[model samples]
Target: MKTYLQAFDLWEIVNVGIEPPMLRPNPTLAQMRQHNEECAKKTQGDVLPTKQCFRHDLYKNHGL
Candidate 1:
């Protein structure tokens, strides 16, 4: 058995009804792609795919 206690429940704090600033409202395809690319670049400092990094391994396993 486990027991846990929280300092405050969800109702204890206030939350705004409007969307947070980080969220986008119906972005265009280009806008969405740019946002995704930014996030990917942020994660690794540079964005790269495993396929581009390990071509020999791909050819050995799948001949692709």
Candidate 2:
């Protein structure tokens, strides 16, 4: 059996096997807008939000 490295770096950032400390699915559109507004306030301006950008065709074609 192969042993994995214990150190964390970019490669271990998004491993699915580990539990995320602050991961949650975005809520409905109204809640999303509220969250977006709050995030914009932190940035001190409007930010073009792309949290849920999707390219269904690409994933479908590429077998992602």
Candidate 3:
């Protein structure tokens, strides 16, 4: 296998696969406020937040 380079100069100012950026451009403050308001209107605080799947649940029901 070809090993990756260890030099730091060429990578000090680059976007690469090894350490990709964490975030991108987000909506403006006004847009975000509008979206949050719309979501709240639809859910009305009655819906409970949930994760897609839990680690324990997956292990318990592995073959189902």
Best by TM-score: 1
Q: 1, model 1: CA deviation in Å?
A: 28
What is the lDDT for 55 in model 2?
A: 53
The positional error of residue 34 in candidate 2, measured at the CA in angstroms, is 0.4
lDDT of 3 at 49: 28
Q: Positional deviation of 28 in candidate 3, in angstroms?
A: 0.4
* lDDT per residue as tens, model 3, 1-64: 0111212222312424455223337878887667556535544432232223454567779954
The lDDT values for all models are: 0.43, 0.40, 0.41
- Angstrom error of the Cα, residue 2, model 2: value is 41
Q: Which candidate is the best by lDDT?
A: 1
Off by over 4 Å in 1: 1-21, 46-64
lDDT by residue for model 2 (1-64), tens: 0012212221223444554233258668887666555534543321223212345555777887
**What is candidate 1's CA lDDT for residue 43?**
35
Clashing pairs in 3: none
TM-score of each: 0.34, 0.30, 0.30
